[model samples]
Target chain A: MDELNREAESAPLIKFFTKLQPLAPAVIELCEAHTYRVKIKKNALLVCPEAVCSECLFFIIKGAVRGFILDDDKDITVWLTDENNLIGNFRNPGIPKMNYKEHMQALEDTELLVLPYDLIDQLYAKFPETNVIGRKLLAIHYHISQERSILSRIPSAEARYKQFKETHPLLHFRVPVKFLASYLGMRIETLSRLRKKSKQENNLIG
Target chain B: MDELNREAESAPLIKFFTKLQPLAPAVIELCEAHTYRVKIKKNALLVCPEAVCSECLFFIIKGAVRGFILDDDKDITVWLTDENNLIGNFRNPGIPKMNYKEHMQALEDTELLVLPYDLIDQLYAKFPETNVIGRKLLAIHYHISQERSILSRIPSAEARYKQFKETHPLLHFRVPVKFLASYLGMRIETLSRLRKKSKQENNLIG
Candidate 1:
């Protein structure tokens, strides 16, 4: 049963890689060879502050993770990730030196495909097409970050909330309210009021 | 004299690409082949809001550029780039359908090597090693963006100013104070006062 569960979990990751479409066969083979399957328990810290990030990229097979920073007695959520998402410090590929600006924790019992940075370097050396995949993926992530940065500059909190909802509709269901509130840069009270108001309006529309 | 000046300007770009130690020789050749030299007058917009960004990447050979947005009748500077920097909407690689969230303008008469997005795609298909270069470059840019996001969360404008100066010392001389003030999320008066206070403190230390 355990073996069967593992196979079932890893299936999604295979699908994810296959969907990239443009990735060369050798690059795909490199991914399959290098990636290791790992299971993390609920609330386990995947990444912590004050240390260089582990030279690994994680592909979520199942479960959710939250990235946050402890700021002046407050935990500010920066990002949330779940199944089918890739998470890692994609910043410093050389020397693998990156001070952990955020803490990443598994929100539930999580299954992940962990690919070491060295493997990626090897692929870069051997399979140049991997770089193209890397560029496309990074470009998508950059776009998202740029969009978020733009949205944050808007003066209205309500507008920001709406934008967030529009962009990440699934997050509201998966993430804890407190963490979601923090991610949105709003007080819990405001989040609660917004949720209540939105629910009531939804009911009226229904 | 004009031809000599062009050669001198493009020399730096060749040096920059050569420094990417891991890049294969063929990949470098691809870069050389695809890159187009262009000149822009001071204050000319490179990117504009709501338009699909041009399918190109720019390597600055000379002068500076600023990325900004208009918010409530005020221009908010989001980023500044100078010599030896790469600038582009690294968000979209195909179809070039990226709505510009910020306006990018040449702050001075600028020389750039513009590589069309299609050329990169071609390199990915032909050279393969170009993928590694693309990945490494994108990773570096992503890292910088992540660092900025972390810095922006800090509450103190003074602290942000110090951090900005520490990270981008050269920008102080190149960027206009008004734009820099906006980028740091502070008023011009506040920035001026902070600058004066810091200068006085530096003199005392000196």
Candidate 2:
């Protein structure tokens, strides 16, 4: 596209950024220039383990994805996401080198707005306000990661399921039970049993 | 307390900030004006669950601290830190309010440089380049959290132990076996056996 599409597709992303911090017109224009939309088919790999450092961050417009690392031939789910979220290489883009340690697969047909890492670095360097957004996003992600770290170490299966359900009420039903179980650090069977028990309790309450 | 202490105590902190990015004389001066050192006695609470939002971040000059949440009367370790590390309320200081869900305690007599949240917010507002340091720090903390998330999900106790020892070689011997076991999501007994097995293997190999 020769011209910037600011009207429709970029509106949501602009909203996302402004919600974090107001952007100068110049910063907005820069972002509008570099960001573009991508639609990924269901089961497509958004980020493969062998993928080179694309060094781009994705803002989830719609659909779902999972981040996992392979261990002993098994894919261990480390992160799960849906709409209105951001995912990236996670390595600092300012650094000269990076290697992908996780694979990101679209669990459903996905739409994302891709922003190049170089643009982000440029924005931070060129605009002071942009760093507020950068800092806030990183803080949010760090807090989330810390929560997941705590969740993984939680001792009780029921507790873990409950916490997951509470935090991801929509995803609880949307995501396949197996992947959810893996993300919760439990076996599929255990999660299934917990779900059955939870459903029964909900039915009684209802 | 009346005047800025720029010479001796602040050197390590200035060095730390400069390593992230060369600070402007003004930003550097502002930092020196606000940051001061505190020494915490061993076994004392640096941050308690009921502790008010101190709104101060600690850069660990020496000793160790663990961040844990009370679950069913059990304090589950959520984070562990040592020298040259940062620990805080983990809440965005820009926010008007916060509630502490974690307790931080000094594992040994600890020294730390305290930087108030207000000064941090001011830095991001006044000096654009300071945001780089903020972004970089958050990225690092987020990456660390992500790694911990993965470590907590690793299935095998031996694998977890091996990974922890590899990553935190000094912590392996320095931290108590129980806390390390808890952090690794293994019982102390299981960790002891793993350690015994590891030592035996090393001995045979040696």
Candidate 3:
């Protein structure tokens, strides 16, 4: 990427980190030095099932990615990431376990900042502040995972869909309905029916 | 607690931290100064629904605690922690959101080292090495949570139970069967049936 283009691409990520916690100039410089940018086409798989997941963490500059598992030929969506969100397999690098039985695929043409895990480790060793940032990021991720686990047990498909919509309004427009439905642990038919009913209700309100 | 008893109790926790990554004497001293011990009786709730969760991270010394959510009188177990594992709310202190719609209950009489979040923050600010330890701990937690999420999607109850048993042999003996069944997202009857079948198979092998 060219200088101006690179600057534009990194601006959102810089803003994201600063918002999480103020990053020192040195930390920012470390991030800039260690991170690289990539663009993926829609439907491209970022991480594949049974493969060693890349040790790099990704910050989405634009577009969306979805994580899904194939169960007896059925694709079940596990998670979705949108602009300004980070996505990566958080498994310990030391463990020789097979990569998770899930694939991360781009839902749209996407731009990402890839920060390799080795560089992150280096940052932790060289800059203590990065470790603080790392903790904050992981805490947020853990909180979200816990919330998703709780929501998965809600027992009502419609309620689950509504909660998903409320929590991820941007994703509603960015992700296909089928992926969203599966992500919410519901049938595509049920999601369609709910969408139609919701549209009618909105029309009546209007 | 008496000084001698306190010292004995904290030794395990100090060992746990040192094992995660070496802690300087000053850092260990900081932890010792900031942490306190708690004894929870079996069946007592450590955290309650809609309540502000204590701003303390808990290191399990002995016994078990299970995190569960009540849905229309049905208690669904989300997670279980055993000896040497750490548990914490990890919710942003500034966010007034009720600390998750879940409660953590002691499954057995439990001993814990409670490190207040503020003290942890101070440690991170003062001791850079603590930040590295914090990140490692969170990374492990994040990995486990992701694994659990993946495991929950398994279609067969027996398979899930088998995986659970393999992964948490100690918990199988320590936690009640009902909680285990709930944690596995299976009916108690099914869990019972699976257990009997597995026992019979083991007898055959013997």
Q: What TM-score would chain A of each candidate receive against the reference chain A? A: 0.82, 0.90, 0.87
Question: Which regions of candidate 2 deviate over 4 angstroms?
Answer: A1-6, A48-53, A93-100, B1-5, B48-53, B93-100
The best candidate in terms of DockQ: 2
Candidate 2 global Cα RMSD: 3.5
Off by over 4 Å in 1: A1-9, A22-34, A47-54, A70-75, A91-100, A186-206, B1-9, B22-34, B47-54, B70-75, B91-100, B187-193
Q: Rank the candidates by lDDT, best first.
A: 2, 3, 1
Highest-lDDT candidate:
2
Query: Residue A194, candidate 3: how far off, in angstroms?
Result: 4.1
- Predicted complexes: DockQ each: 0.38, 0.52, 0.41
Candidate 3, number of clashes: 0
- Please say which candidate is ahead in lDDT: 2 or 3: 2
Candidate 3 residue-wise lDDT at A179: 86
- Per residue, candidate 3 scores C-alpha lDDT tens digits across B1-206 of 56566567678889987877888888877677667778989999874222322567788888899988777677788888788888867654123212346678899999888877777879887887787787777777767776666566555678778877778777887888888888877778999999999999989999
In candidate 1, which residue pairs get closer than 3 Å at backbone N, Cα or C atoms, i.e. clash? A128-B128, A131-B131
> Which ranges of candidate 3 are over 4 A from the true structure?
A1-3, A47-54, A70-75, A91-102, A193-206, B1-4, B47-54, B72-74, B93-99
Query: Which residue pairs in model 3 clash with each other?
Result: none
Contacts from the true interface found in each model, as a fraction, amount to 0.35, 0.59, 0.34
Local lDDT at B201 for model 3: 93
